[model samples]
Target: MTGTATLCTVTAPLTLFAAELGMDEGRIGLLSGIMPFFQALGILSLPVVLRFGSRSVATTALTMRYVFLGLFLIVPFFAARPDAVFGVLMAAMLGFAVCRSLAEAAISPWSQEFMPRSVRGRITGRMALAYVPVALGVSWAIQAWLDGRTGLDRFVPVFAVGIVIGIAGALMLLGLRGGRAADSNAPRRRSLTEPLRDRNFVIYLFASALQSIVFVSISLFLILFFRDRLGMSSGALVLLVALIPVGAAAGNVTAGWFVDRYGTRAIRTALQAGQIGLLLALPLLEPDVPAAGALVPLAFFLFGFLFQAGIAVGTVYMLNVIPPASKEEYTALHYSMDGLAGGLATFAAGFLLAWIGAGEVSVLGVDLGKYEVLFLVAAGLTVISALAYSRLHEEGALSVRDFVGHFTTGNPMKALWGINRYASRTSEDRRRDLAFQFGGVGSLLAKEELIAALRDPSFDVRHEAIRALGHISAHPAVLNALETVLEYDGLVELRYAALGSLGRLKATSCAPRIAQFMEDPNPLLRARAARSLGEIGDLSSLPRIRTMLHDDPDLDCRLAATSALGKLKDRASMPGLVDLYLEQASDRTNRVAEPRSKVVLLAITKIFRCEEEFSHQWRREEVQSGLAMPQILLQLAGRVRTGAPGASAKLRELTSDYNAEDTAATLAALAELLPALHQSRHRDSDLAVDVLNEVRTAAEPHPALLVAMAAILNRIFAA
Candidate 1:
């Protein structure tokens, strides 16, 4: 971790120094290929690694790495010999790369064999946390020290710092305690070629190898692109280079948890597919474009960030796939393939760039250089790789579409974040918060957590978990648990929560059981049950709910029943509803209109299919008029049904005269229906026979009332 503070990569000051010599893109590619190619060659150390403990072999090789780096640092002093500079520098780098390769070959197997699997991931994370800030700080400091200065003198200080820190890190490797040399005679030992025979592992290796070319070369090539193609200053490029590690740290932090939550293959597929789009966009970001300066660095940042995440998930997947007995062989084989793939392609890309030197290709009239063409090719290859990643088997992993859907669906990540938060937080408020988060997701991923939470000691947590279960759809466990709570749970609140969740889940199978609760002593339980029955959409519960609406003394019971009847859209309930509305409308003792009256009006509108027509919210002037209007309309329909005198003609006139599409129309129709019912030629006929008998007096604001009053006044004077 400390050694990474030196910031020695194939890309940065190394590329900058390589370009300072007269080497073209070809030699730079060759130089970039050196470390990975030697790392690939390090698999030859398997015999040596097996002969000694993993830590011992890795430590010895890493110590030699620093010695080579220290020798490389002295090359700047011999800069006076211009003819020998390239050979001497190459020789020094060759030695350093070989030693580094041997260390690389030993480290993974050592960690796998000796370190606890639980702590390996944590240690990797802690190392990154320690390394990133130092790497960023050191990079900026070096950029400042360089200050656009060129030549061999710059190489000495950078290499010296790396050697010092790297040597310390190497020596620190000695502190790690346990790993035994492999026993050739042991019965449990598996063949080294066992991983090769794994079809899924081979497919994974193929995909990884295909990706490695672009993966390893992208940083190095971008540095050259910025330097030669865009004319960026050497010092400024240092900061640009540092953005890679910075972006990687951010990405790794996010993926570290996500891989565990969601699993690996789906994430890998999503990331690789996303990277394809990024690569395709890169060719369009030419120097002349308005955002190219910013976009280019952004490309580098994402390149590092996304690949770091891929590595994280990929490592987890590999660990899962590898057999317990052959961890060393599996790891070494994987590293060898990765290094070889990266080495060969990077080495080839240099020559390919050299072949296309200072040349341009016109595609759709857009002038693209070798870098653009290479990125296009990389994008094409990435498509194949992403598809390959999709085919890799991961048990219990969601399909790519479903995994991606979590981000777009109702705050699932927040829910996931809460699920992780639950174990650490024991307070009732926090536990309840966890339940709230799980409820919003509406996914079965939270089912086990939410259901287990149902039995939590904290009543708040249990009650909230009951509510959260309503949000997750189609789980037998959730539905069954809720039913048990509703039927048998002692607490009324939990039972109430269960009923609401059943409604949200549309658990129609529970409708009959829920209907039984409508007759319960608790008004709260009765109200919740009625609503759930309505949402479950079982027509059998309609009669019971209508009876509740007609007879229940509880305000909440009536509200829920009326709402249920509305949802059922039952025309049969209209007569009783009109009776209720007329009683409430004419009751002048109550200053404020009752809420049940408004809800009844809404329910009636829904049944009549005129809900959209008279949908404005009720106010002081609107309530009585609104309630009376529907009452009159329902009564007229009832009369027309029974063939009362002039009833059919009156109803036809009312419908034709006022469309019932506006408040004024309803007011006008109510006025006419009042007279037709009140002053029929055959006054002996029963106009109110089919409905409630309490509607003899016409509703107010009638011009006919003035005439009737005048007639009565004349009669009074004559008497």
Candidate 2:
């Protein structure tokens, strides 16, 4: 359709062909006006779409459009006279227009049904991008072919190629998953005129129609401004025309990102205002003058860009405003009105040209003419449209300042930096309050101030200060402050924040102190202590967490302990968790068992990746034979929280071969793995056989291997 539409535009072979046929400007206007006239009747075509469903109607229309395009190619070959050729051309165009109108009516509603609202702007922008290169290639190909050739003969091969490409597009549509079932038997919920009863929708309808007039005016006359007013060469005109699609393509890319993230109301306002500005500038510049020729392509580019951006955002905005149940009816009405306005606008441009003439006129000492008057009038209508658009509301829209910030920077990280700086300077809070805000922003510059804020007279300030410090992660100063807060701060919230921050910072040295908090009188404090211990990843803290999970009277504290054990990923907690589950389940009246069961399920899921157990097992076995096994070996060693092999003389000899860190890690891994291996033997898991085989082979008198073997056996069977 795009390739074929290009051929029929006012700038194209149709314009020259009309001239060759000696058709007057009024007749040429009527020719360019054909599509929208039928498209304005697009609402009347809705029954065809609803009857067969949008998918079927759209596909059939696209197919028949190509059939008409084939006739367009062959018509010129048969008709020798200008009258016959003109008649056939008009007939072909009418057929194409009617088919396209049905498709246009179907596709918008079809797109709305399937496309997610969150990313609609992005997808629309990408669709515009896809159109750009094709439009450019077709424009270049047609222009280059017609450079030296005259008459209708040049279009034959172009139309033939268009038919082929259009067929490919049609075939591609056949594969689309027409999302919803065609509910032909569904009862009508409301009359078609019901949407017009919506006052806001009526205002939107007027705004859309007004904008459509200006858009059509620019598209119909921009080439004439370059050709008649500026005297640009055909070659220059061809190249300048390509700039329109390029700019529109670029607009889609940015417009989508802005619309999806920031909402569409601001984007629509800005683009409409931009269009008005560009239109107002049209009368002041003369491309024929020195240094002004450059503005012609730029004006055309901005024109296309603004048109596409406004339409893209407006379409998204319309979807947002319309009731979901009546989307198809409302959308069809909107397009019908838009098409009517565009058709009238095209005829009005021609009528003004014929009636008022293109001769120069002056107003307010400004050099203006008929084209200039047209531009000014269009700008006036766009102003009204812009005002009307502003009346509509959208949810989650960014403030104007933030929208401009996003527009200029185009990166969220940079936007956050800007926001942080603004919050730092503009906030009315005192230094301590400002420090708290900076902590939310994760501003490293506030580190010293946040550390100082920890000593503020107010406990609230100290609580926030600890939290902020945790977000920055612990430095030596932060760790010291947290320790001081835990030891001296009388407030429970402050103490909880301090423990949490220590765990988040992975302050390994603080683990013992955090462990002692598990015995605090407050069950909440005990829960926090258990969680922090797990976060610190200290194996020695396992005994405290295990005791809390099993013996704590408070269910919340026990649940937290269960979570901590899961984080530790030790098999040693399995027996205790199973016992806890059975104890809770035994009481039919216990409401707490459900949540506790979820916690146990979660722990087991985390330990084994229940969803991907086979995959993990495969990866682990693969890693055992590879160079990366040492890292896994160290992690396994770290899991050996509670039980250990008493140093068998054999195990001590093997321990002598490794560095302190590696030996400790291996011992932890073995302690954890040993209990898991014992359970695996009952289930007849392959891991049990592998572990037994490894032990038997290593039990040889080679002292180092024997020591390793004994470490495994002693950890497995020891109480």
Ten-residue segment with the worst summed lDDT in candidate 2?
698-707
lDDT of 2 at 320: 73
1-719: candidate 1 lDDT, tens digit per residue: 44462485334777777677666788778777877777675567777777786788888888776677566566566666644666666776688778777787778777665645444444444555555787678778778877756666876677677777777778888888765677767754435578888999998888887777778777568787777767888878887777777767666665655565566788777778767887777766656989777886787778767776676667767776777677777877877888888888888888888988899877789887899878887887778877888899877666787666665646666666676778685788888887887887776667668888888898899888998888877556678998888765469988898899999889988888888898899999999889888778879998888889889998678778877776777777867776765666556777543544666666665654445433432331254433333334444445544334454455455545443235333344333344344444442223222221333243632222121221221122222
lDDT of 2 by residue, 1-719 (tens): 54445543424555655545566556666666676666776788777777777788888887787677666666556556766766776787788778878888888777777788989888888877887776677677767876757676765676677677676676566566662434767786535787788888888889888888878767766766667777765545665677777778778767876787678877888888889889888777774566786788788789878986887788888887787667778878888888888878888887776665656667788766778888988989999998898777677775444455433422345334434453353433354465566566554434556676776676676777788777764556568888888886457888888888888878898888888899899887899888888888888988878888878999889888987887787676766765564455344576766545556545644443341332343254345432333433333333333333332222343334544324334444343344445554333233333433433322111222222323333333332
What lDDT does each candidate get?
Answer: 0.69, 0.67
Counting clashing residue pairs in each candidate, in order, gives 0, 5
Residue 5 miss distance in model 2 (angstroms):
6.5
* Model 2 pairs in collision: 636-669, 637-668, 637-669, 650-707, 651-707
Please give the distance, in angstroms, between residue 545's alpha carbon in candidate 2 and its true position after superposition. Answer: 41
Estimate the Cα RMSD of every predicted model relative to the unseen true structure. Answer: 8.7, 22.0
For candidate 2, what is the lDDT?
0.67
